[model samples]
Target chain A: MSSIKPLVAVLCAGVLGLQGCASERSETALDQAAASFQAVKDDSNVLRSAPRDVIRAGESLARAERLSSYVGSGADVRHYAYLSQRYSEIAREHSNLVLNQERLAKLELERQRLQLALREAKLVSVQQQGKWLEAQIVSLATTQSDRGLVMTLGDVLFDTGQAELKNSASRTVLKLVQFLQLNPRRVVRIEGYTDSTGTPEDNLTLSRDRAQAVADMLVDLGVDEKRIQVEGYGDQYPIEANASERGRAQNRRVEIVFSDEKGHLGAPR
Target chain B: MALLALAGCATDPAPHEQMRLSEQALEQAKAVGATDEVAELKLAEDKLARARSNMASESYRDARLRAEQAELDARLAEARVLTLKSQEQLSLLQSRVNRLRKQLGEQQ
Candidate 1:
């Protein structure tokens, strides 16, 4: 039995030597696995963004190391080696995916911020435009009425008891034309009124002629002809008591009404 | 023992079909820009390379396994691309809602 024990020891040593040779034969796959593991561990992005995948890759690499130490270079060793490499690749991919997500979020945030700025700028522009329009209307001494805005020209606009416009009134017509040119979107209506100093038929005819003359003046000033309407109110709708000469003068006037931006002139009140 | 040997000797008749399917899946992933967009797609491409090499060496079992894995990875890449695109769409909708809210606040 003592002699047999020496024989068994020699056989055990021989088997161990064979195992060593097997491990040596598997060195290529084992080295590749080690390199992949090291590469993943060294990648700072992988460490920062893919902690879970890194841990999994490390686990697979440990398994591969254990498989490589086994008694034979076989399919199991190669399989574990492949798994280790694949897990390392997965870790890298996960890190890249995280980076992509961060970039997308940053870009989206920038877009939203830019959109907010654009909207704010548009709002400011609209408000400034509204203010400028309001200032222009005030400069024209126009009053807001049921039919948009109204500007009144007293009887001094015309020759006494005649439908013709006086030369002095040309300045007022020019100013009106400048205002209308600045706001081409607005439509205008001219209404002529007369005092109760003549026969009703004659007053009506004079009023109608005066309204048409004013409209023709606007058209001559480059305002669109279709944008102007003419009306006559003879001995009607007096704003002041016509018992005195001053009241009569106010009664015989021409009123120019401007429509809104949409050219909507509300029903005359 | 003889029956097991016979089973081992039997060849897989559909190896070519399996290889073609994996190649088609990889092509589809590439066509969708997955290789640059999704990092996992590179892994799938590597697996496909391995599968082709195994096929050339007549290692049918290894080739089949690698091919299937490659196909699975390619599909995973496709799914990831879809997920990222959906996230982008969600962000766009969120921005639109935010803009509308801002406009409403300004009107008030």
Candidate 2:
């Protein structure tokens, strides 16, 4: 009886040792896996920058661990069968992920190409279409150049201190809309500027309000909201300095920048 | 004689058993090549596996050394993973700083 008691104790101790070792090893393995995942999350900048291999390996390891959940027991036919199925499934999953990554990369490249083309076209149009405005509005740089629109706020638009579009200013706005509508493909950007006569804070506020008003007016005239973005620089960045009357007159102006596609970026609401 | 032979073969487990367990643990080394440390551990595990199986069938007393080597390799791999994780965290901090800078510039 005493011999049997010792044997039982030894067996129990052996089993416990095995369990401890397995658990410790598993703990270390899990910690490593977690660290790897954390690295991928931190490093991946874009949608597909994370390592695909880590994701695939982690999935397979999880599946394998699930299969061996009933460890130390006798061989389980069902467990083995499940494991085999899981292996095949993991293979398919890995391939699918690779395919998805490739597809996404191709799409991004295509988008970049289109964006480059759009930018080039904008540069050309900016150079060619708005040139006439410099001569017609105020002869700042080119009295007769074929590039870029130049709208003088002092001359044809609102009064020196007002944000309201004047009666004739309405005609100019209408003409601008007509130009956009006729082009039907140019996205317009409205930039508002002001003279240094007011406080910087006040100028900033006024410039923003003026830009918003112009944008709002465009929207009312059937321009898509998505295609338009408004930025107002009060007196910080003036094409012409604020030292002279003529320069201030030149400064108080609005410039329209169009998007590559003239239609609304989002649903026209 | 048969009983004695069976006892010799089946009695107390060999050090090779410990090595086998370690080898099995190595199977956790995922089959990935991601620059991540888990992959490095797995790769190291495969190398350690070569040493392990050799020790398993080895006639000498080197199995003990082989098992220890595998453990060391696993530890190294885990360390690599930790380093990668720390690097990743640093990169995230950099990104946050960039975002804050951009916001400040826009405000101005």
i-RMSD values for every candidate model: 8.3, 11.9
User: lDDT: which candidate is best?
Assistant: 1
**Candidate 1, A1-269: lDDT as tens digits:** 46654554465347656543434434567678789889989999889976775776677667667755444433456666666666666666667667667767776776677677766666456455555655765675567645667888888889887888878878878777766666667788888889888888888888888988898988888988988988888878888888999999989988888888788876654
Model 2 misses residue A184 by how many Å?
2.8
**Model 2 regions more than 4 Å off:** A1-156, A260-269, B1-108
Candidate 2 lDDT tens digits, A103-188: 55565565556556555565446434454532333343222133233344443476776777667667667666655654566665
Score candidate 1 by DockQ.
Answer: 0.03
State fnat for each of the candidate structures.
Answer: 0.00, 0.00
Question: Candidate 1 on B1-108: residue-level lDDT in tens?
Answer: 223222442463336888998889788877766865476688778888998888887777668768866865775586567556656766776677677667656755
Question: Where does candidate 1 clash, by residue pair?
Answer: none
Grade the docking of candidate 2: incorrect
